[model samples]
Target: MKIFRILQIMSLIGVLIPMGCSDFLEKKSQDEVIVTTVSDFDEFLLGSGYVTYVQYANLYFLDDDIEYYESEYYDELSDVMASYGFQSWQPDMWESEEVIRTNWETYTSTYSRIMGVNAVLDGIDKARGEIEARDQVKAEALALRGYYYFMLVNTFGEPYNYNKKALGVPLKLSADIEENGMPRNTVEEVYMQIVEDLRESSALFEKYPKRRGNYRINLPTVNILLSRVYLHMERWDSVIVAANKAIQYSEGLTDYTKFSGSNFFMCSYDHSEVEWIYGVGVNIQFFGPSADLLSRYDKNDCRPGMWFDMGEYSTNRLLKKDYDWMSGSATPVNTVRISEAYLNRAEAYVQKGMTGEALADLNEVRCNRITGYTNIENVPANLLEEVRLERRLELCFDEQRWFDLRRYGMPSITHRYRYRKSDPWVIYTLREKDPLYTLPLPNEAIRNNVRLEQNASAYEPKRSGVEE
Candidate 1:
């Protein structure tokens, strides 16, 4: 089936299946399908625009935050080894036959959703409903489309701040299927479109001013995403502006002082600080926290007690808050929280040389998370470094670490991998500013779109360092 047509069945499925009739004779022709109401478009938007399922778990392996250990039963799971390229920072991670088991969904899923949102945007203006209702639906579809593009440009293209002219994922704004093999857009072009979509979304939402549920995009979520995008573009003042706007809508930070141990793990879905809940939660079976990440938390910090736990294998430490190995479901995914607004502002302040303001924002988070934490009164010499550390600690596994590492000059990282617990360790190194910083277009994507060119691979000459 064509990717653009994925959402056409959304309305039919919603209308027919619920009536308990699966007969094809009851179905209407594609030309007869009418989604002409605000409610109809709203329902269509939910089924297509929202990424509630696990899509980008492979993103975790690219960062230094995770450590991989093969279990005694590792041989039983052929799929687990598909991420070897990602863990080693190979450019072919998405394209290589060795990594075939890894399902690269970000490219396909984002475009599918964009097509869905495009359909809504194309038709919502004509839908029969109150002006306010139609506007709100338009606002939501715009926000979702902007978000999908942001994720796409960031994942497949070079960091905007690094090289705005670099090749980005293909840009598709219309629901109407264009010719096959659409070419890539520049990073700057994609970012401009993202900003434009998000700003338009914000204006429409503000005009309507109806509160959307936490599960859906609202005014706060739009501003928060804007802040993140600005942060990536190195627009420090814009970051501060957007972050402050989002902070005003937030309830406040979640104090770690209130929670302890596995008695109750703190999940972001129900937390007060959360602005949006989307994305796949971490699974310990595939990856665990690196020693470097765990070391960043001070002994006085309460997060370790709330976040990490011993995995099913005694040797592994799993992110308890992400996924409880016991009876707890592994459903927690991407959470955009108020605390990130604070961190974003803090980083922006430091960049703009507002050290005191930066420390104030930084310490606000620390005071809440640490026991008996005294505010850092004076500006520390490494205030910028301090803010980065705090961000890694607060936002670890929330899908910010890898991007942060990229924007932080794509520092060299080393990973130790073993096929099994008893096997000798093999070291994989990603050199500073490696071409792999920008991920490859999925092999299938290139095969389908002949206009697409793959990014340069980091694995030049394919060197796998000496084993330990």
Candidate 2:
């Protein structure tokens, strides 16, 4: 990518640059004025990564709603996601101008934000902080860079283990130096890069004592993410180890069962769990199940509803700013919870042929909720079906539904079930393919990278069915 163009875009976004911060705001301090060194630059740059990381959640809607709901194809696909498990963008189901624009903007912005992060990592070393802080900062920055990459990789890149050699976007770790039209890297290569970054991050943070907030990625959060990555990799042994480490290092959830009152949703600290390594939450939630999906359940279900998944440590007043405006977890402090640890353990058991063990892990989660479930145990006869239900209900909008469905062999963006037009009242079963699997790399990115092969399915015409 051209440095000039990239810089221009970054400036427009008010990213990585302090020039846009003032109406000539007072005067600069002595230290601030002279410190144009890389360390200062690094500090400036590092903030951009956090910005990108925050936007990752915005992409949740595309996968769950749009593709999962279609004509007859809708009913079939509900087996994967959505409340009605349909009503999103199924080929041509949802055509509102507002929803369409929001959908478009949310998904695309994730890529744009990453460009800002790359800028900081590429040029922030002239004046590294004191020896200790300098190293710590780099570790956090590097790991976060990988964290953003992993999000993009999973969302747009095909499953790495399922198809090791599948093509994914080129690694753009450095904003200043990526080539225009960079070619796709093998999915394995993309994963290798992510693994390396996470491993480096884990080692550095383990040694650093002061890693409680956004400043440094903490031990528990790292293990949490590591467990997730391993599960995605289908590395059951690694998944088990990471899950155990997370549990041992941190406290578990806030015991939702014991929390008082009907308004339990607002408690940020419920179900005592470990502190998140890099937590960023806001009460100003921008997305929820569109009206069509919510029409299926009671108006108050806080669960992801086939859409998706929250945060804490509030110095920014963020936790309170939009607290009264949204649904799902109350307080802006959303979390990556203890439930994830159980989910991972259950998945690991599945791979080990210990179905009983998997069921136990799952039961542990189901039995704990104040909102109780049936004593259902002994594992489902259809193994994939069991995983799908557990993962869908557990992970919800946590951004795991699409991947879980994909990994389990029914990979498609379009809903699998079909719907009948005459019977808005009737739910007929049908399956169709209008897959929204991996994201289509932005037109701008693809145009810039000559070597990059566009996702072959990127331009599939919208039709009346969901993809398989």
Candidate 3:
């Protein structure tokens, strides 16, 4: 990598202040920010190592759960114009005329945070602190790095189960800035790293076992992440084991029946069900539920009424804003909750031919979220489908839908968009097993590293016209 690229990584974590290209080359590599205290590492991680929900906003648009409603001035609005490629599933999503698009923000943001985490992991061992405190810092960094890789691999690479041999994101395990860009790892290799980091995290947690707030990583959070990863890998027994541990350690589920107001139901970070509160608040005002997703909710389910604005065309709006939307601050959303552990176990049970156990898990979530809920005594014939439906309903808009869609065989999906009120709808279809399922490496990445190969184009050349 060039000095500029190395500077990008260093500057992202506030470690470098290179004045000019020529001047930076003369300075010693060790002349950078010096953070040598346990307190310094903790603050550094919190400030630069964390990712906001905005980093995942693009994925939310790609999932089938969202329905894009275009206005008459669609082409005039900058946001709508910029999002057109992603909303329509175009391969040139990050290289469009509407925006100066050269890179995927999600890709850059995630890798940047991973670099920050790497910084902490690189030097925290020698930091001045108690052994247990250093262990806590190390555990959090390991878990966070694993989680970041999980996001990157899922977004920029093919699904692990679909093709573990497929190309994945580069594994940057060290804080040392590279003079040459690294090659992409195999999907299997990336997943191996993720599992290793999480295992280390789990071991460190066992040593310290400290409870930060739900906003931070804990033992339960690590287990939940493991269960999710194993679920994607189709390791059913591993999912059951990890999810069971998460459930045992979690604070327990929040009963929807207890709250009549949907506004504050899941708005607080301190909610009982939350495992780790992370991610920036998404502007739900820009999107709404897809008809397919909306139909999955039962009439007796309390979520729809509480979670959505049920007025005319309210299906185009998500009513559940973040806890601090009333204020002018970003609300950190929870990526893992107690309900997910139940759902994970349920799906694992169904795969393992334990229909009764799966149904019990479904009932556990349904009973808490559904009003006038009736416990089904008998296992349904389509037990796996039932578990999947429940999982979708419970984890919708929480950044799981897109990945779920990918692991579920990358099903065909269609999005309809119109440029104006008078114009007919333009149909955009992502056919089953389409290469579009795996996003291409960001152009900036490929430019920086000739060793990196971009994924296949997502565009379907034959299917871009307006439907009459």
Candidate 4:
């Protein structure tokens, strides 16, 4: 009860900056704490700061999904947009303080969630509650913690296949805050922790009541996260197993043909296709779908109309209708959907040489998105490529494309930007396996914790034709 109350106060003050000094961690509020009962613990889990959505604005700039055009308001560009634009235009932009701070904020916010999770796990056992209620609370905390760590490692560390020995974000396991510096764990160690936590969470979910919405983690969500983890680890058979388990519970997909105009702005909160929802709102005024990305969509594919708006001059901007109009937040941006499970299974089947099974799964999702949908009879020579294309089409602008590119062998990315209507387009390229692909740790983080080493390939300033 005391720990939960402490966590409640800490959550309010945003004091859970991980590995901070003991004095900061020990500070407590005098306000009457409410986390004395099982229900109170549940409320703590649902607290605003603890269960917040992730913002994708920073990651969006790094991917090839968006394009930049000079606005009439400025022959030049605004500072905010200019900062992000340079990141897209110049490979060395990661060295900039602005870019480093943006990335650092995401890292700090994710670990803050982990801190809250550890608080619940540490106190749940002592609460006077029904056995089932305690287990359910603990399960949710484990899942949430694992989910945060998964995001951190993927963003800050090298892809699993690239090097298991590569450094990952610090792995924090306890509620008792440590003032001392913590070393980065290897990618393999971090991944193993994620798997262990999720696997335990799955077992605990059997004791918890079935949750109604995609907003909260449940049995199906656990399996879905597991499927994703397996996919990243390249455990083909496990991917199929986990995906199948998730599909058994939630298999609904929105029928695009039956739907009417502009469903693109619909968040997962209202969208039937979503299986789990967790993404923050983003402003895409200057960033729109790339010409190349728009080209990938078939004319008949309903997704283009539903997901993007081709305004005057055929400029493609993501539809904001699905987002919270009043608050400008988008629901389910960082979610796992039923379609993703099928995609996961399909990809796994392909890796396992079960081309027929893979194609069947692929067709399941394609039929729902394309008009006059028909199943493919013969597998294409590039079966994996075809599946990957569907993933890009299905999951674009949702913060998956950037990570997908990295995991898929760090493919070359080229972005074409035009400063003015009269200016010829200038192309910027990120070569395959470029050091910039793995962003450097924030300068402040390295300074605060001596144990935290800077990435080998820290950003170096390079002049590009685009004005900063």
Candidate 5:
């Protein structure tokens, strides 16, 4: 079948099903035939229906890493200035339909991809094909599903550390769609499902063909993801084990010293160091690094110069060259690379009181990014704090900082913005453990499915009469 026809079928699959079940499986359209052949399922998995990049634009807005110039020119652009609510730590940034739509898209798009994966899992066993081809398709789908769920839970559900018993996104296992409403699963249950899928994916990958592309998920990628999931679950020992396994199979970090100051490289997925790359493309025109974040980079650290540029107004805009801007290309706003594995291991080591091991791993990453770097012979008493700082500096704008802030005891974040050079600055503060830390579900989603429950914190009425 043609790709459009397949997508149409997928759309119908998404819409026809009722809200009762948390699984991605929806009732099939009467007009469409059930896809049973491995070839058709393989084509569908690789087709446009499968969302390759996950978009977390809302999460990016919530981080302390960005700054918007307060100016008459920017203020005239309502849509552009609207983002200020996110940066200013407003409680209900989802007031506008556009903002709500963007947030809602993230939820639906991710689940759509999950639905595609479920279709493959449901049909692969019945399809007649070469055993290797079938196994490869199944393994890839399983890994992709696991990854999507990980993203969903992290974004929509409460932080695992906050309350495992807290409500999580609905858990959908099978592809069979039904008309029953499903209650939210506990955070623990959702995590257990993610772990199960990823573990199965890891075992399946060993039997499948070697996956070479950074875009594709294989054993190493699966392990790296597992490391992240375990880190969130506070399974420190398991995190160390998973990170070490992933590092053993993946590429080492790129040495910044090799590139001249003027020729500093951008962090792109094509870079040899990236283990897995998946995220929506970011438009650098509207975004820039906060002065405070930029100040953290050491004079010798090459990343500051490489990832940012001073614009005409002297503002430090994120470098556009870091992403693929060509239409249809997957511009990764977030990624999983080999360096993260090292950092994951280092954090886990610090939690286990293995300061020396932690420092070794931390220095390993610093050695590559900082010029003329030297390793310390002893670990500091504040080794965990040191590791956290390194992680923030290293992964500044890649959507990790905000999540880190939440998981790290929800530290208070204060942002300062000025409308113009001569204007007094407006200050906004995000308190630790504030309810706004958790985003509310989109209004449309709740309306469409009455059974859906809103986050307690997200229930605040939208603010009105706020200055643009």
Candidate 6:
């Protein structure tokens, strides 16, 4: 977990800031771009644009070790799952002191990247060349801007579907900078702008052939992101359309056969069929977990099996046939799969008053779980509730359950257990949030940005070493 933190923190400054956030809106065209007049702003598209870089600064990287162990921290900084090898964090997990703070810091990079995009957006209005290519640049710049805003809004602001029109990061659309000490914009305004950016990004990126290579953005990734944003806003129609479009370009549904293959566990961003779009590579590793969480599963499960199993029903550690006492490096695969699209569609359908259609999508995902079960024809009328629960169980250990629970606006579930690895089992809460339900921005960020204010409830303990 400490290693993950080192990587995330390092990238915030080393990777994103130093690199100049160019990739955030870089163009791939080989043709030399030529600018003519302000009317030739499209020509600026030919000029070197900033590349888009997605820094996957993880939760474990954001907070100290203790927060990583607990799925929920009473105070956000106190407990987090990144310590146990989960890179993802929930927005509602506002209490993960660093989650909010580091994510806020992550903005330094994202917003910095946006400046590059905005520079192009501002500059291109005059220089011009291929009208279509120029148009594509315009679209990409807008989309890139939207993508960053989405990340910032999701992390710092409230969900679009919910309340409040007050305060979010400053809306810096152009690169020509002025005041660095801008407060936030209203959440309502941010969402509206975000909607415009994504819609435009989707349109622009779609003009080009899909981008491939380990970490580049392309048409499909934009679709996947738009779908996610729509989900947050509860725009069911847009979510369904975007997800389905993304799935069209998707490859395979599962790599169960190769799941534990060489370097599969920590290798970051593998080529799995279900991945519609992914950015920022990160390796995965297992570390701290309070023991009791392990007690629920069979002893053989790699994650749940690390500890002793009570085995009220069985004695031996039950290993999944696929794991095969796996050893050595295992690559990490972190992308929303086609399975996720099905899940998203299920929710959209449920909202659209199409329970039967929703159930079909839900079952499609359930039927494929490594721990498979029959998809029931009689899915409950409360399909949303069932979807929420399935998301928790199905997505557990995927760095997702924590966020899923928080996004659904439910108090997350918890349990207690001891550290059984080197000693006996102990008790601890697996999940919980405190104060305003969000962790304070990290102390470092609070001190860095004058415009940035600390959430009163947020504060993490001083750490002696890297988070273990």
The number of the candidate with the highest lDDT is 3
lDDT to native, each model: 0.74, 0.52, 0.75, 0.70, 0.68, 0.48
lDDT of 6 at 28: 26
Stretches of candidate 2 off by over 4 Å are: 1-46, 52-59, 62-108, 123-126, 214-216, 265-271, 277-323, 326-334, 354-360, 371-388, 411-435, 465-468
Please provide TM-scores, in order, for all candidate models, with all chains considered together: 0.89, 0.69, 0.89, 0.86, 0.85, 0.62
54-99, model 1: which lDDT tens digit per residue? Answer: 5767777889888875444555344456667777766566665545
Candidate 5 residue spans exceeding 4 A from truth? 1-9, 12-30, 33-39, 48-54, 70-73, 100-104, 261-270, 313-316, 320-334, 417-425, 461-468
Q: Over the stretch 155-253, how does candidate 5's per-residue lDDT look in tens digits?
A: 667889998888878786655553554567887899999898888887777775457563556677788888888999999999988887787777677
What's the lDDT of the predicted structure labeled candidate 3?
0.75
* Residue 339 shift from truth in candidate 1, angstroms: 0.6
Q: What tens-digit string does per-residue lDDT give for candidate 4 at 1-468?
A: 464455443554255433233222333455334355676566667552245554445676678877774443344443343454444534344445655444425655566677777777777778778889888788888888888888778777888888879998888886665567678998899999999999899888865555647467777778878888898999999999988877877747777777765545445545665666655544445557778888998778888776665656432255533433345544444555678888888999999999999999889888888898889999999999999999888877665777788899998887666645566666667778876667666565666567886675565455254332
lDDT of 6 by residue, 82-198 (tens): 222122222233334443443424556666566656656765545435666566667756766777787666555544454446355678776443435556787678877887887
Residue 124, candidate 6: how far off, in angstroms? 4.6
Q: Which residue pairs clash in candidate 3?
A: 1-179, 1-180, 52-280, 53-279, 53-280
Q: Whole-model lDDT for model 4 versus the true structure?
A: 0.70
Task: Write down the TM-score for model 2.
Answer: 0.69
Candidate number with the higher TM-score (3 or 5):
3
In model 4, state the lDDT of residue 187: 86
Give lDDT for model 5.
0.68
Q: How are the candidates ranked when ordered by TM-score, highest leading? A: 3, 1, 4, 5, 2, 6
Model 2 scores a C-alpha lDDT of: 0.52
36 Cα displacement, candidate 3 (Å)? 0.8
